[model samples]
Target: MEPVVQFDHVTKNYGSQVAVDDLNLSIEAGKFVTLLGPSGCGKSTSLRMLGGFEMPTSGRILLSGKDVTRVPPNKRNVNIVFQDYALFPHMNVAKNIAFGLELKGLDNKSIHRRVSELLELVQLQDYANRLPNELSGGQRQRVALMRALAPDPDVLLLDEPLSALDAKLRQQMQIELKAIQEKTGKTFMFVTHDQEEALTMSDTIVVMNNGRIEQMGDPSTLYGRPGSVFVANFIGETNLLRSTVLGAEGNLTALDWNGITIKADQGGLSPKAGEHLYVVLRPESIHCSATEPTSGNRIKGKIRQRVFKGNHTSLAVEVGDGAVLNTLVHPGDVAQLAGDDIWVGWKPETATVIPDRHAHR
Candidate 1:
């Protein structure tokens, strides 16, 4: 299948600062692709470029195999749902949804048909006569989605559409948005700084940093096997351990961290005899015990703090070598309290080796 949207070596600059730098990505038809990164990472800039609100300094953007880099926003078959919803206060819900069609000079009868269909699509048919001010945050968001979808754009671009809502409403809208996308089957390209939102809604996630594509993959793949230190650290909480590659035999690579030896996969990259490496261990993967395990790489640590987060408990342990490991254990299995000594261990496969980047160290 051909990619519906493609960015080839894309770069965007403002004055002397580069916002998006040499980004290359592809999104398949009807796929929900998210541009995810923290603020100033250029995810929003990339979205704007795709929306035709901004032009790339270099490279091209292809929509359905046609170059739309120079095309104006309205001329292209794309619509955006802004964070603020961008609905006019004077326009009722029905008129707001019909606004796009009206600008295109559609007849009143056709506009009513399209708007009605969209209102039902977003499950806001009953709110058609209501004003934007009268609607709740989630309801207003639905209105925004209806307006964007009323045009039947080939792609829908969402710019943090749920960011303005309260936390509970944001969570509710995330579910609603995903359901709407699946029901409509339209290509959706969303931009968000929230990693959890991207992971939950995206068919494919593009992790960007410093205006460049850091990693792109399915949520599980990106989360479980982050290609870089930045990706691993950014995607979730992890214990980043600085170590040195000791030796490798077959699939197992031995690493030495402050004289503490541990084994991991070879990671496909050959390491020098004393080459520095970093290990990323997820909190859930680390097993904490009151006593040291007979097998595996076990380390003793004093629990610095504990946080009970409903389902599980998070323990911050201060191990040797100036390293702190945050481990999550089941509430039922948690044995030690703050200031108590405990042993943490994990299987060789649990820890993945990444580049020894300074940010991770």
Candidate 2:
């Protein structure tokens, strides 16, 4: 089967400032893919290029095996749900949802049937007569989705559509949106900087940085084994330590942090002797105790602060003059106190060591 969308060596530039740099990617049909990155990282730019709102400075965009590099937004079979919900205040929910159908010159009876189906799909059937202002944040978002899906486009693009809602509403909308997407079986390409959103909603995630794709894969693959330090740090909370690879045999890699020797996983990185490296260890993977650890790779430090989070405890320990390490302790195993000597330990296989020289660059 042909890919639903393909970007081949795509590049977009505004004068000398490149917004998308030599991007090559393909999306299968009916898959949920998200473009995630910080602000000004070109995530939104790439989405605009795909939507035909912005033309790529170079390369081509193919939709369902046809080149759409210069296709106008109206000519492409795609719809977008913007962050602002862009609803006409004078139009009620039903009118807003039917607007797109009317534009396509559909008959009144068919337009009514399609609008009804979309309203039910987004679970806003009861609120159809109400105006956008009468609905809640989540409801407004659903109305926006109904408007976008009313036309039954081949692809749907969401641009931070849930960012305006409160925490509870946002979470509710995430589940609702996922359910609607599954039921419709439409190809979706969402854009957001929220890592948690990308991780939770996407079949595949594309992490972008500085107008370039840093990594792309399934959520579990990106989280469990990151290809670079930027990905490890961006995806979740992690404790990074500067180190050097001493040796490697099989799955284990001997490492040295300054003068302390420890063992960690190679993390698919080929590090020569004396080469600088950084070990990424998730906060929850480290076990803490009042005394020095007798087993596993241990690091001694003084407790700087203890944060109680109800379900878990976060300990900030100062390991060196200005270096602090954070570890998450289970509520049941919360031990030690501030100003006390403590030990943090992690199994060799639990940590991933990658080259550090290029981390900040």
Candidate 3:
């Protein structure tokens, strides 16, 4: 019962720059795991190292308990689906999927059987004879995925594989990719900067920053209880308020933010009195009204702007100290709170507090 993939204190460097710094992670079998971060955050570097495409500067990478840190990409029981799809233009879907199996010296009958099965997996069975150019963007992507999965690697490494499709297609393929992974019961290590993609598809998400992991957990845990200021702002849209801890009572900490007393759960953090901290509130957490709701932390703010976002409206309310709190209110409520001097109220427990070590301001 060992981890299907493990990175033990792995580090990768490019000259003086550290791409992945002393990383340790364990990915179990048959789960969709995503390494998510912005550009140059070392997510791709880590994936490359795991695929044996790049060697780690230090530390070991084990595949199911066997050391494969310095092994070549071809020698490892892993296959990668690059962002470009990497399919041959001249080859049809079946041929592309059969390429790896043929290189492994499988007979014609075996290759055709495997190819047919894969084509059926993606529901592209009818398109097996169609060339890459003849297929849609989503179809071409499925071809690439089936090609990588055709080899039946111990783990499948996807390096932003859905990046090429349109927004709608991308969303559609996210569900498809996850479904395929679950159906095949293959261990998938996916890499992407798209937060929504990771949230929608991954069973676990590893948020990375500056070549280091910021946090790793299930989507709801990371979104609801971010460990750092960077993570709170990165995973989703949030209003971060600079505050000073006034007092602590068990799990709740009183804060003086913008001259208003707000109580937020320390979330296991033990902050001493007068410590500087940040309170993270999601847009949906802030309730907007024209009248004060005799509950929670009520603050007055001028309605600065309202954006129409389909189902709900996004409002920018300017509070005290020139601080603007963004809140997503239902479209019905926007009409009532349209004028100046709107009341914004949110329970203190709705906010998450983080240390100000990496606060950007």
Q: Quick one: best lDDT, which candidate?
A: 3
lDDT of 2 at 151: 90
Total residue pair clashes for candidate 1 = 0
Candidate 2 residue pairs that clash? none
lDDT by residue (64-138, candidate 1, tens digit) is 899999999989988999989999999999999898999889999999998888888777888989999999988
How do all models score by TM-score?
0.94, 0.94, 0.96
Instruction: Write down the worst ten-residue block by lDDT for model 3.
Output: 352-361
Output the better candidate (2/3) by TM-score.
Answer: 3
Model 3 off-target regions past 4 Å? 358-361
Off by over 4 Å in 1: 335-339, 357-361
Give lDDT per model, in order.
Answer: 0.88, 0.87, 0.91
Error of 2 at 125 (Å): 1.4
Model 1, residue pairs in steric clash: none
Predicted candidate 2 versus true structure: per-residue lDDT over 1-361, tens digit per residue: 8999999999999999999999998999999999999998898888888888999999999998999999999889888899899998999999999998999999999999998888887777898899999998888898998898889887899998989888888887888888888988988899999999988889999999998899999998888777788889999898888887788767878887757788888877777777788888888888888777788889888888888898998888887566788888786676444346888888888888866757448
lDDT of 1: 0.88
TM value for model 3: 0.96
